[model samples]
Target: MSAKIQSSNKKGLFTKFLDVIEVVGNKLPHPVTLFAIFSLAVVIISAMAAAAGTTVDFDRVDMATGETELTTVVAISLLTAEGIRRIFSEAVTNFTGFAPLGTVLVAMLGVGVAEGTGLVQAALRKLVLATPKKLITAVVIFAGIMSNVASDAGYVVLVPLGALIFLSFGRHPLAGLAAAFAGVSGGFSANLIVGTIDPLLGGISQQAAQMYSPGYTVDPTANWYFMIVSTFVITIIGTIITEKIVEPRLGAYTGGEKASIEKVSDHETKGLKWAGISLLGLLLVMLALTLPANAVLRSDSGSLMSGSAFMAGLVPIIALFFLVPGIAYGMAAGTVKSDKDIAGFMGKAMSTMGGYLVLAFVASQFVAYFNWSNLGTILAVKGADVLQATGMTGIPMLIGFILVSGFINLFIGSASAKWAIMAPIFVPMLMRLGYSPEFTQIAYRIGDSTTNIISPLMSYFAVIIAFAQKYDKKTGIGTLISTMIPYSLVFLAAWIILFVAWFALGLPLGPGAYIRL
Candidate 1:
């Protein structure tokens, strides 16, 4: 692998720019290390700010009295003995109580089983390969978008499959890879159906919103409407980027290695059939539980989307939704022979999450410390004031926020981790600006997701580089980032446009969630 070829590809001007990003990004420390540094910095900053008598005032509605009262929040330094003791005491609780930790773990448990059964792989391959040659690109992009339903399945399964599919049809494999990567990572937040991230981020948003409005509730389906629309928007934009920009740059596929096309097996097909049936049956059962006036899943007022058992327990319900069908497919596919086999699959699934567990611990403590020290509140209030002073309001402020979030994503990879830290600040600030936490969450999601492909910090970026290495062994960080930069730029622009339009139209973000308070 030649380093020169990797850094200076024939892509010219853009490659040079992306090379800079790769170089600068590579200099940054690991995410865990960065979080540790950030935590320390927060402590020192909190101390300095506290000593300087930093404070902010915000109006909060009293739950009991039903009246608005002004409250002054003063930054508390974590440098004191009591602060240190509190930190040491709450360290374990912080990690254990992190909003996204358990939700992601439980969701991945079900996802792991499904992926372990080979059902997700088989289905994705079938979806891509079975499509007409003319629509292969569109289908690949759409499948990539839909693959978010199962965590990381799109990257591990669909991306390579897409490349192979395109290569088999005599198209550029890198273009195929780009298209699939765009859909999987860039369009991550856009899914026709609600995904694990919906609940994960929604939970974080709810926690942040509570800092201002204690009784405010954020449902998992809070961004369902916007994301559902985004599904098609991303698909179209991803297809255009792949067909117009990416493919033109690559020109033709003259790579030496023969692209190996993978096909679905008869047994895998049978497994998919049974899995689909089981999934449909599960949906029917869920519908039965929610559709009736006196149904168990309904709220006391018979509302399905608000204050309802089904809505409140969406995480567990999502877990079971994945678990049952996974078991069904596993049994049909001979993957689950006995109870031990199922247990083994579950364990294997958890084994992959070891890194996430570590990341979650450090990230949780950072968020908790920030919250306990009143830094998040004071910062948000002050930040809100600054934004207000800029005379940026409504759609423009929202657009500015999207760009800011996108910029932060270049450094931080974990969507939930970033949201965990950011939600505390941005969610409340936006709510004060007359926007809902759910609305703010969806904006963060767009920025976080759009830049995922271009960011070296993304957890799957290395995996993608390795995937690209199959065709070009010299492919390195610059090579991969350069290829993905187009998608990142285009996705950000198109998504922002969609968001602006949605905001202008005053459309509801989800079932009961609106753009503004």
Candidate 2:
């Protein structure tokens, strides 16, 4: 009785904490409205800052000449006439040109076909059924960790599928969703294979490193080894958290009949077989294009990771890959009789994106306004100056950097964009203190990725909320954030400890990268 009382007391405290988060978060307006408010705030703040002559000057390295030059970033007041005119004129383009807008829509088209024909559902069912009962949570978490290879596609595909898989096993769907989201967003920077972000952030770090060492180049594979190790670290941590904390708190499956497991029929099994064959064929074709010395996917220099057509076109390639297999499954299942069915599937997918489209428009405007105001850059510069003044060095300093980066990540959603602004400052500062840009970059990544699952500003955060609402209508930003706080906090701590250990041991971060300069 006393043991049960202690457990109940712990549960009560946790529930109270979550209640506080929900109340505070719910007090805020809708996400769309919040973005609009942020946009307006940026404009007002920009005008005030410009009036006060706010500006930052930093040295920049010229890529072409390998020379250092001074550049100044003055606050740009969006309240000005030209700014107002530009904002009005560019609103349409901003909405249409948003990065997530196009990629998500294109990918969903193919996913829609697979889902509509029962292909995706059958495949997920098979995946879960094939896994040992004891390892279901681990499998979901591992799949989520690996899904980063396709970028944001994981948020769209794997997260909801995880929930469905858990539900079919008479488990709490939200716990499954949390576990997957933790892996996809929280473990984003950890992958066994080099991802699009490796090149993107590498390019930014190279530019920053050039300021201190002319003609310096940061390889895209700079963090590959560390991240490869991190993949397992995050998987193990995520699995443990899901099984011990999240699932227990969520308790047993209480959702209605829709959540029950249903056996796959013969037709769906046939569809899965056809889809598997089609997927294998696609893999063979991709290999044929990439493996040969003179293949089209290979760079002129014969490298697959850098300056390659394959790396550049991965998103579209993934879309087409899914499209073909989806169509094959649909046809095998007799759900698609003609090309019209395919078109319909794509159209239906696009239609469901209406809310996201609206959110994207407002979000794009806010992001643009923030950039135009130069506030993010100025804040980064000031933050760097403060860190530099601290006189801290070694692992402690890097841990401090990680904390700063995580805090900033709550406001800035885009990894590459934040890194672009931060690298020009932190990378050079760290280099002067006997650290390599690669090491600094990894520190930044640890902070950036761990907080993503909780940040409302993250591009797909809204979509995750929508996914959650399917299970519980009352699901809000707080519900997700509160649940994910454990993952974020634990991941941050574990990753930092790993980084410090690697640093102390003088281990190489990658093949050609080290912690110390």
Candidate 3:
């Protein structure tokens, strides 16, 4: 009895800690406002650093000449007359030229159509419903991971479906919800296919990488290979946690309502079949364009993956990859009756991105100013020097970076927003330490993803709590975080181990992306 009381007290303290985190996180400013503030702060700091004559010298490789030269970066004050004029002149271009803005918008145009047409939702339901009862946990988790392809569809669709499916099987509904949440949120960075986040983060990393190497390009597929492997690893781990830990801990379902799993309607099934056919047809067309040595999509060197027309047009290709199948799905399902419907869907998608547009505008100015001031370059060099001086190079330093990223994730829920701010510092810093931007980006992603489930600041966290309350009236922030903490802890450990093993084996993070420069 005494021991039980002691354990209860410990749990109570842990709950209170999470409650504090929620309060603090909630009190923070909106992400867009935060970026605006960051932009202003950068302007002020640039002036201060310039006044103080802060500078750094580093060896820069001349891309055109293939020669290394010592380059000195002196902080430029944004408050100066020339700086103020440049900022005013470049403001419009900063927003327009931002890499992530166009790529994410283009990609979402297609995803929005697919999602708007109900194809993504139907596909997720079909995947989870088709799995055998014994393998349902793994399937639910896998479905959640794959649902990232359609943005927030997993949170809105699969999460609650997971609960209903579990209740249908006479299992605890919360266990299924936990499993889905684990995959949707905790395993966010792990997906078999490239998603909107891939390009969004890649663009940010590329922008940051350019601070160190002018011609360096980080492709959307930079972390594709690692993410594909992580997908299976997370699935297995999530399944194990769901079955061996979370489910058992919940004991049994005592909820009032009995719910059955919703089966896909006939039209949706037919739509999926047509969508699959269209997808295959699209693949065949792509193969025809890239298979031959003299193919139109091939590079001058006859490479398809590197410096090729196909590689350069990847964003449009990805857009079409979804657009074609989505159109087909919609037609067969009667969700789309005319070309006007497709246009309307696309417009609706862009309309929903108003908040993102505002955030991107401010963020781009911040990035441009940081670059213009030479602050990012100087910081990278100084940071690298300090790390090298301390001899913290290699796996230990990488692990520490990941931990810091995870800790920051608790307060800031937007992955792209956080990366935009962090990449300018960490990407170039890691590059100076002899790591590739791709490696740094993937490391950041791992940390960012692992802590998402327990973060109250996550955009979908409130939605999750609302979902939980349907089953348990007492479900609150503490209860949800406590349930998810096990998944978060296990995923962080397992993912870091995987990252270390990958590093040790000298594996390619993605096509043409290596561990070192």
Candidate 4:
């Protein structure tokens, strides 16, 4: 982006503040450096707390007999050398044992086939291209938000495609990147399609909540409606911010880089048609499986909303949902003609995972260390304890919780890990304070998502930096941080207002839910 600011463009205080953070944070240290600093700090804090015997000591439990009883104290402590050894010794076991890891990979296998067969990209391009320019922004943004249902596809496909889409229209590619990045990362929680992340985090949160309330549950899509609405809200906000704020600030396109456009390859066109058929067939099969009474796909409770078999197995279903059709489309489109061909498609999909594997490896160790140390548990329990002690109710408590979540996210970028650490203490503590698990989950999601753009520790930061390099070789962490900081601020402000207003209005956050405190 050009640094020449338009004379008509005026600076605001908040904009300047973001600019400073961008410049300062980029220069401070690499993301890995900052992450090491944080891990060290957590270790120290955990050791001190363990020494003090400050832990998640259960104050009391409301037993089945309706009596309050003091419960066993679960002390939160830091990892020991033994724990580190255990983690390293059982690295493979730990990797394989983590159900979500394999599940994510397996689910992606099918998604990769679908994407590799050129089904997903073609569909997106065709669908969005036909849309009017005014509506295109929202469509692309919404698609970017929904792409989370397929995980890394958004980063790999949508981000690049977004920049291309903007450049085709004689607009700055960075603006498109800004738009797509906002939806993909900042508005992560808000999506029309629910993905594996929902259940993974939900399960973790439920387990955490049970530390105090045995019967507590945290729904994966607890904030679905709000998020769905936020998709549109973010589209508008992102467009305005990109068009009115960042673009003008960066000035004109005098940069050395040349922007070239991509053509619709004949193969890509054929791929679209076959992929369309595959998508239709997949949809039909899903409907058939789900339509009949006592259908195999239905939940145990026989409702689509709760424990439905399909909902419960969303990860596999999502995989099959994409893979089945994609494979068929590939065969028809001549991308794949046999099982080996299919395997090749999957192999291609898996290839992209190399970088993710590296990130996940380090992230797993960090998470394991933190878990063993019990630092997260201690912080969570202590924070919840303070909240309960304050006796603050309703909006203040919820808003404050969001703030805390945002703060935690700066250090801990993994949503499930952070929630796993926080859920047990906060979920139950809030329940005791007369709140719902869903409400707490919703607040946690808002906080977790909003900071993703600004946090260097966010796993995708490296990928995003590479994305920027395509447009400007000079682009670095500081450039990315500066580019993304606007979305973080804008999204946080709008989302917080929407959530607080929702709280005041006393609306249900999701299906069969209430937001009352």
Clashing pairs in 4: 77-373, 77-374, 78-373, 79-373, 208-424, 298-309, 299-308, 299-309
Cα displacement (Å) at residue 334, model 4:
2.1
Q: Candidate 3 lDDT, tens digit per residue, 216-315?
A: 8888899999999999999999999999989998998887968876689999999999999999999999999999999999999999887899878888
lDDT of 4 at 218: 57
Candidate numbers, best lDDT first, in rank order = 3, 1, 2, 4
Q: Pick the candidate with the highest TM-score.
A: 3
Model 3 worst lDDT window (10 residues): 59-68
lDDT of 3 at 436: 94
Across 1-517, the per-residue lDDT of candidate 4 in tens digits comes to 2344542243354456556654554565543444455556666776677778775664555534446665545444445676556656966654555434665677778878887777777767766677787766677677788888777678778887887777667667777777787878887888776675776666655555555555555565666677678777887887787788877766665545554545556777777776667678888888888887777898766787666777567677777888887877687677777898778878887887775465445444555555566554455556666876777766888888898998777766778657755665577667656676777888998899889888877878888778777877887766777778888888888989989888888888776455743
Over 4 Å off, model 3: 63-66
Q: Tell me the tens digit of each residue's lDDT in model 1 across 399-471.
A: 8788888988887788987887789889988877878898999889989998999888788888988888998
Residue-level lDDT tens digits of model 2 in 398-495: 89889999987776677865675577668877765657889999999999999998787687898999998888888887778878999999999999
**Candidate 1 at residue 224, lDDT?**
93
* Among all candidates shown, the one with the greatest lDDT: 3
> How much lDDT does candidate 3 score?
0.92
For candidate 2, report its TM-score.
0.71
Candidates in order have lDDT scores of 0.86, 0.79, 0.92, 0.70
Error of 1 at 469 (Å): 2.7
